[model samples]
Target: MTASNPASVVPSIHDRFAVVRERIRSTCVAAGRDLASVILTAVSKTQPDEALEAALATGQRVFGENRVQEAQAHWADRRAAFPDLELRLIGPLQTNKAVEAVQLFDVIETLDREKLAAALAAAMQKTGRRPRILVQVNTGAEPQKAGVLPDDADALIASARDGHGLTVEGLMCIPPADEAPEPHFKLLAEIAARNGLSVLSMGMSGDYEAAISCGATHVRVGSALFGERISPLKPS
Candidate 1:
């Protein structure tokens, strides 16, 4: 689906959503996976409130954010009005903001290290809201990335599940941008299988089809839904 102008008046959110849903449907059909099994997490990071409202108008309740503060600012008051909105934190989380993260997000997808895990556990206890976690795996072993190294996934998942009393439901990954992501996606699926994990939050706007074929349960897409982001928010 072609994206409308970001500079000009934006296209209807329902139109964009239809395009994305069609893509997802085609991908699922090609992969021989049930359409009901895959989830489309509209990556709404850096998008304005109007975009969110348009999405809501189209019956899109699930959204992904890259920053806690931005999401909190945007959705704090709106959540009450739209009670079913599901906010998934698809960005790296700072340990210091664990409490705020727990308060703001429904699913925390970037739990990669022990320090963050401990902080989140405490925050969940204080808030009495246990957000489902997906341990991020640095499948490419990129030093600059925010996920745990592939080798360390097992131990961290175990720690988050057993020691920290957190519900570690699955694994997430962002493959190296320049390389083919199929291997990395397959590796994550294998890791999740070994750990008895179900959710695989991999893929983005560019490679979601490949990810679904590799068993990605959730695909985070932005540009395909909202056009190119207006601002390049730094990775949090």
Candidate 2:
């Protein structure tokens, strides 16, 4: 009946972060883009505090979280210690949590429907905090996914910008796991370009290099940076 140490089971967060950064650097170079152009947003969801501390020690400031409550638990207190931390809500956000999301997150990357947009608009006005917004596009049109379908993206973007007075800064997408990601990436980039949006948040640990080549301004990498997430319920 011995407890196991997570450190021994997973790769050092420092080493993993360095490897991801180096890959980003090499990918950017090969794509003929400045390394600074692509933001390495370490997807920190489900990672423990120790992992976060290690990531912060490496000067990794941007993080993406999938849940509001989890993000609050992970970073609410750490905000003072890491003032430069930029938190992006990379999951489906419920309308009821708009206020908290607006107050906590630096960027909300899953703006899909008009009701959520209206909620966020009111929340922003109430809290006096305007988080950057990215309309998530469900390029694969998956029913289970949270993003707006590709055909409906422009209307939503326009509504977020014009109807709600929110500054929709960019587009985010998660391509179907089974399909090739480049086409989805290209579609997202095209949507951004036509809308005059500059930021394209696509790619994950597996296909970030291809995403860089497709003009992704931000890549949300998790396992590559923090090692595979270990489930809390799993036996040690």
Candidate 3:
């Protein structure tokens, strides 16, 4: 499809949201759970502003972005028009960018290491932002991934809570693409329960249903909502 084509040919944001919401509803129903308990975070990294406008018009208040720079550029101004919007940083964070991340996001879902934890704590002290945080656990133990290993998650969470004075609200994870995600989701849920944390930010578009069934409280959905991201949009 070409850009010149009428917008009618493109799936309306309402249509996409309805489809995804229905899927979430069905999944929750199947699990004997309340739908309101789940938070549907539209992953908006690399998505164009027009697409974001469409989603905002459809009342999508929660969104996830994969990069600090991109999110700062894309949302800095647009947020003025949607004061109630909530943005979550869902990507791996660098120690150097902790202050910016603390300022730019309402939640940070990729808290994975001590260095990063310390940086974020210092940043929070400097900025007084203190966005809610989640410890990303590398449940699959993939060397290339950016989460704390499963064995280390408990200690990291404790440090973030007791040492750094950061609010470790929950746990997040990205299971290996080739593996069944239920086990990982289940593990995250267990970890959260043991630590008295309430949020379980697991699941993507492909495995969200299973994640929900296994007790995911937040699902980061991108492609299913906005379609595959086009080439990066110039930050507006």
Candidate 4:
């Protein structure tokens, strides 16, 4: 399955899913984790509906997108396309877009600030639906990133849970590209546990296997499973 439009090209969904399944299985086995514990979400950032639909056709219920605009245009129309599929916002939640993000997405995997958390809370009040969210952490503590400071994670998590809206599930982090990931992933899991949180959303296409081994409940993967998503879709 190839498409001239970058979105249409899904080299081999099954083959790709199989490789991922095998990787997930092996990682679970190696980590002494139940293979069913980790759920694989095919990140469909730049891919077309067909690509996502194809994955959904294969019984894939989890799908992720990186931008509010992209998710809105690319997947908002998908309520009927993949009704049972779970849609997640795997990117930073813009403060202004919190309302729409809450309305459209099942999960916002990038909740990183008190303001946005508050905004999502307000949004949920209007929509009568609170979105499940994970606080994004700048685990590497990079100045150029979007997550809240790793040290401040607790304050935000507490706020989210106490808020009238927003289900504070757990933490999400993007480690520095140059780092080993094991330490960072392990750190995220440990932090979540310490806070008594349940979900630890981390890792992407490249090192998710390691992320899973370290107890990542949700792995957001794209390029590896979808074959190097081309631009105008940059890796988030």
Candidate 5:
């Protein structure tokens, strides 16, 4: 199907989804990894409802969102319709939103600090919902980012696992935008390996193939599937 511009045909969500699936399949084959080992997490943040519907129609059940409120708005009602939907919080999570986040998401992929971990542990206990957790590591150590520094990740992971009784499934990272992503992916993989974490949530639309090769178990893809976001929501 084409958009208003006759000169350019816009691929439907199904087409885009198929293309991405093919890419994942081929990348897995090339990496000598099982196709089922890696998951394609469709990033639905900032997308219109119609786009989300289209992706759901295409059988995409795993989605990643950036904000707790936005995610609640997007999936709260639809949960009844799509009971199997797996929601992941891929952005920085605030301690205050822990209860809401614990109730809504199936996986929390941004556990960075001890305070947040404590909040999540409390939230999980209060809500009686234990979503899987992944520690976000600031591999580049960029000051503006929201992840545990490489030097401190082990401590945080241990605390989350032992102290808080939260499940530290794996690690997640967003490499510095200007730098090559493979190094960051490698570092994340190394950390996961040393920490005995099997799930690596370390890729986006731009570098998922490389992430798979570097042992990513979950890849968060957005623009490449939903088209460029037109109106990004301000960070909450």
Candidate 6:
């Protein structure tokens, strides 16, 4: 664990977690918001089991997985080792995989369209398990992303509620990455408010603090909490 060793890591998992937690706390405090309102979803996409073990040692329970197949790959054999972990699928969900997703994820963060909603409804009915779902909104209007357009935020959630047969728990967004995320975060909060939505799931490793400042209910931290994902190209 010498500093110069190639394998030597900075910010022992405990230290990294403390930093992330403190960041959330200070950000929430400075914004005059309740720190407890900000839930943390450790984005565990492509993370190894040992790293997850380290995270668990620090009491990190909720984790976010980007793909359904990856969840099946990572958690299937090792999840029981950590009794506290709750896995959630936080990426775009395919309707065909709805059944498998329900069995593995405690929450689905990407219920975007009517067909997907209907699929989740049918899957939940057949499986007899309903998961908390957050309507994903493309608040930043980035074309390359997967969320619903900003103008349709409320309508999408309504469709999930009326068409999906599941609880419309909240709103989740991935703001444009290259610029300041605060404005987009604030807009998401406003959208949630306008629709009387209770949960706001915005923020990531870079701008989670900003998101918290603007009333983000959940922050997905990966690199800041865990190390940089082995390869950034993959969803985190």
Alpha-carbon RMSD, each predicted model: 3.4, 2.4, 2.6, 3.0, 3.1, 3.4
Which residue ranges in model 6 land beyond 4 Å of their true spot? 1-11, 78-83, 232-236
Query: What is candidate 1's lDDT per residue for 1-236, written digit by digit as tens?
Result: 33334333245667888998998999999989999889999998877767777777778888999999999888899998988889999999999999999988999999999999999999999999999999999999998999999888999999999999999999999999999999999999999999999999999999999999999999999888887776656799
Candidate 4 clashes between residue pairs 3 or more apart in a chain or in different chains: none
True-vs-predicted CA distance for residue 194, candidate 1, Å = 0.3
Q: Pick the winner on TM-score between candidates 1 and 4.
A: 1
Q: Which residue pairs show collisions in model 1?
A: none
Best by TM-score: 2
Give the poorly placed runs of model 4, Cα more than 4 Å off. Answer: 5-11, 163-165, 233-236
What does the lDDT read for residue 219 in candidate 2? 98
Considering only N, C-alpha and C atoms within 3 Å, which residue pairs clash in candidate 2? none
C-alpha lDDT of residue 127 in model 2: 100
Which wins on TM-score, candidate 3 or candidate 4?
3
lDDT of 3 by residue, 25-58 (tens): 9999999999999999999898766787778877
Estimate the TM-score for candidate 5: 0.94
Compared with the true structure, all predictions reach lDDT values of 0.90, 0.92, 0.90, 0.83, 0.92, 0.82
lDDT of 5 by residue, 49-153 (tens): 778888898889999999999999999999999989999999999899999999999999999999999999999999999999999999999999999999999
Put down candidate 6 lDDT per residue, 1-236, tens digits, no spaces: 64323244434767999989998888877989887888999998887666776777788888999999988988887678767668878898888899999888888989778888898889889898888888898877888899889888778877778755688878888988787888888887888788778888889988887788778888999988877766647576
State, as a TM-score between 0 and 1, how close model 6 is to the true structure.
Answer: 0.90
